[model samples]
Target chain A: MERQPVQRISKRALTLWRIYGGIQFSILLLISIGLVVATVLWEWPWWITAVAAALLLIDAVVFIWIVPGLRWKRWRYEVTEQDIDLQYGIFIITRTLVPMVRVQHVDTEQGPLLRKFKLSTISISTAATIHKIPALDEREAERLRQSISSLARVAEDDV
Target chain B: MYEPKRLHPISSVINFVKTLKDAALPLLLVFVLNGNIFSGDVDWIPLLIWIGVLFLVLISGVIRWLRFSYWMEEGELRIEYGFIFRKKRYIPVDRIQSLDFSEGIFHRPLNLVKVSVETAGSTGSQNAEAELTAIRREEAKELETLIFQEKSGYVSTGEEADDADIEAAQSPREKVYGMDMKDIVLMAITSGGAGVVLSGVIAFFSQIMDNLPIGKIYDEILDWIQIGVLVVAFTAFVVLLIAYAISIVLTIFRYANFAVYLEADDLIITRGWLEKKQMTIPINRIQGIRIDENLIRQPMGYASVTLISAGGSVLKNDEHQLRMLPMIKKNEIQKVLKMILSDYQMVDEFKQPPSRSKYRYMIRHSWLGFLAAVPVSIFFFPYGLLSISAGIFLVFLGGMAYRDAGWNAYDTQLTLRSRIIIKQTYLMKKHRVQAASGIQTLFQKRADLSSVKLTLTSGGGAAVAQCHYLEEKDVSHILNWYLSSRREEKPAES
Candidate 1:
């Protein structure tokens, strides 16, 4: 029951998250631009055009600048012989625990972007839910996976 | 050993009806396209197309019915089915968590039942491993008894499979509890879903009313109700009336013939109107018991009791397994629980957080309520002071939540008490807690308060319960308990 220090996910996750958010904003911006063009072609109301332009500006500022850093700071996890603890949420600050004995499977996934950065995401699955530790170093992810699996095995045997 | 036995021949007729109904939209689409191709000319193509599709559908249904067969072999239900590509399934009898029987409207008159076999492995809505359609009620009952009785080691082999054994197995059971008309009525009146169902009914009717384009009927009704506040009041009253009526009827239909029987180690619950559903959960499979008191029912001294069973799928809520005794009196809860679950003890002494916890709960609750009321009150003008009253009311409710929130640990069990309008006390095995977590936001970190979440496994899935805004030390104690101790075995009587 000795408390282990909660570890923050890699700082590089911030950049990754920002890039992902920017990509999402870009999609919204394109829709806004389309609306502007439609408004001009159809001679739409001035208020409608004003609202669309304002929304586009807000989206760019918030998604590109604010959210990722907040998210990166929020994402923290702790793994021990007993359980996996996660704390993350923007407004409500949700905390979750995944007991080792309940752990069914574990996988280290690396998408194209993550692979380029030498980062892997370790996903832990239980009977009811799945938990993830994103943007870990590849070797670290593998070592954690191994340790978790063995710990899970020991816990399962204990039960 | 694998001599397959087909389901009742009526299964073909059932499948035929099912397939034709399923094919309705496609047939209409084909007819429309055929009309388009011929430009409304008398080509007789649609009639030919309909006949062809009907013949194909009927043939497929018949083929599937003919192919589908299940047999008992080596303690497993081996099923071979499918029309073109043969599919086979083997389900070990012990792996089966529940065997549910539902008599559909058509099957009811024919004395047939649809048996849905569920295992611990399936989690989603389409989780039934195998569904046997159109079996005689007697055969279904016999199958149920054999699977359960043999499972309990009452019989070792299939050699004792005589007709009389099945009949003897069907002997009356001791009814532990049964729902009467009164209980159903109370449950219906206090239910929270009435408003939701009423809104749904209103929305559906409104959609149809909008489509009618019958001009003055709507206007005439609106005129009769008058404008302004009276309209709002009238509408609210009507909605409540309709909602309660619907709720009462739905509750009656759902709880009709509701009864629970204790048969050896299994607790069998059967209910439903047109579809009579039977669910069996072994006593040892239960993980936790929960008692809930609603804002409406609590004042009346009524509460509901439900179990967190490990492997049985509770069909009440898609996510929550509400194996709930709908309208049991709060005072009677302890007695009833003690008799049924055996080891159940209603904990009285609970440790409450300091009065400091009130600031967080009240402020957090009232702040949102105030903000929400602001817009409406400002827009409406004269009734603006009502927001102030609402804000105070919210704070009062929040105070109650803070006051009542408590936790207690004893022997091998832990109890958490919390209120979400409805007061709930969760009693779960302390050692059975699978996971634990604590959350502290920036402010809460400084305040030395954390919300602790404990995850426990139910029969079907993991159920999580949270104790919010407890002192930080308590959270650590809970986390520590998860690792440090060895649990004593439950008492023999249980």
Candidate 2:
């Protein structure tokens, strides 16, 4: 049998996605501040007010920038003719490999946001794990879905 | 064919009586508390009411005791039960998971044991279930042996090979993993801090009225104490902290001697010092594995393993659908996991983390939780500082949630790791997933990100594990993986 080459996933739109996430996190921070102010005005103790506000601010900043950076650093996935390879982590990187023959089903879904953006999410489910690709354009998602389904169908016949 | 022995019919009454005795304390307490709270004018009436209720309960219990009867006919286990409503449930011999025989301290004198047969059913309708309160010990053992032999035979014949094949195909039994007593003790001792705190609060409130100083200038003194409440509050806080620690210690002591064993295709767990329970889980029924690392366990390199199963019965107190393994070291996880799942391989080598952009949706996910907390805090403002504190906690929790969101997928496997205080990694195989779903809220649509969920079946039912927000190209790749066909089996690689 010929050994297959490892395929790497695309990283084209990741930076834009990260920036959007940061903006959403900033909005959360604003909401947290509003909550703290409302609480402090309602006769809460200064210590409680201070702690809550600080935690929320810390949380928002961490969510916006730090978390996304960690995730991006960890995310790596590859698909071959016989198997799929996924590697990801922020601090503790982990790798997993699943054979093509084990796939039980495949599905594609679009939420309101993805719909507006003309994007869809693809999900691959095996007996043990559910792997996903998020934010693909409509045509790309559909094409990938067709290819995977064909592959899965062929795999099923062999099983 | 072996002749099936007939069980003594009187055992049903004894079991019903035992059940009544176990239920009596709570029922009596409810009546007493209600009487004390309601009917202050006539105390004797309340006493009479209690007597009347007790008398009725006794009569009903006796009737139920007389009504229950079970027998094994051919390859079927049959039970005729109920007092007012008669029910007959017949279960085939093959459907029985295990027939358990137990003897209470009281039943020992009578040489009697209780017999319970468990089956694979998620609805928890105890249809193929029967409890023989006090049957002869010899008879109980005979029944157990009969069921065990049947199971052993079925297993030997490769009928139970769905589970056994996984174990046999993967590795040797010695190489399979499981937890020891030390791990169980560590898990119980360090894991239940929140439960300890909650129990302390309940204990304090229950005894609060007894401790309060009543009469004359009590109201005046209370007012003064409220003014200097900060000092008093500090003292109270210290006391509560001590109480919490004690409760935690007591809880650990009470739960000592816990053990988990991986025997062939079964995961057997035994725990509790006073009221010991033995639970046997079939490997095939395990829906998924959840590896959780809390702040306390992370430092020790320990992670708790929880098995998600649809067949197990619910515990009486909490509605937790998953059974926790308590604590095990990260390095030891693979060994223990192999015992439960023989065919699955553990990917021990670390790969480079995914690009940072994968976390964008996690931050967005946290905002939804924060958004929900704002209005709730405003509505409960009258509770003063407590309500405000709760609001703050929610926002903090949401922030922590963002820090925890991340996903990792390998060739045919995917793992979604997330947490706030308690971290969890959901592991599954791509080919075994039964369904996939994509969802997005209106706001998420504008962000061009959507949530992808995949459903996988274990035994009879399914579970959906998800990843939120990824780029369009990534979604396509994942979908392609799912739709991709299986390849022929290659030579096994170590």
What total of clashing residue pairs does each candidate reach? 4, 64
TM-score of chain A of each: 0.88, 0.70
* Docking quality (DockQ) of candidate 2: 0.05
What is candidate 1's CA lDDT for residue B448?
76
Quote the true-contact fraction of every model: 0.35, 0.07
* Model 1 CA deviation exceeding 4 Å by range: A1-78, A87-96, A154-159, B9-67, B82-87, B122-128, B145-174, B212-243, B272-275, B312-321, B359-396, B458-461, B486-494
lDDT of each: 0.74, 0.57
**What is the C-alpha DockQ of each candidate?**
0.28, 0.05
The C-alpha stretches of model 2 lying farther than 4 A from their native spots are A1-159, B1-42, B100-114, B122-127, B131-137, B148-185, B196-255, B312-324, B346-400, B456-463, B486-494
lDDT of 1 by residue, B308-339 (tens): 76554444233222565777888887876776
Error of 1 at B283 (Å): 2.6
Candidate 1 local distance difference test against the native:
0.74
lDDT of candidate 1 at residue B10, scale 0 to 100: 82
Candidate 1 chain B, run of 10 with poorest lDDT: B312-321
Task: Write candidate 2's Cα lDDT for B125-243 as tens digits.
Answer: 34345556667876665555455555445322322324444444433333233445576557655765656676756665665555456564475886776775787688668776776
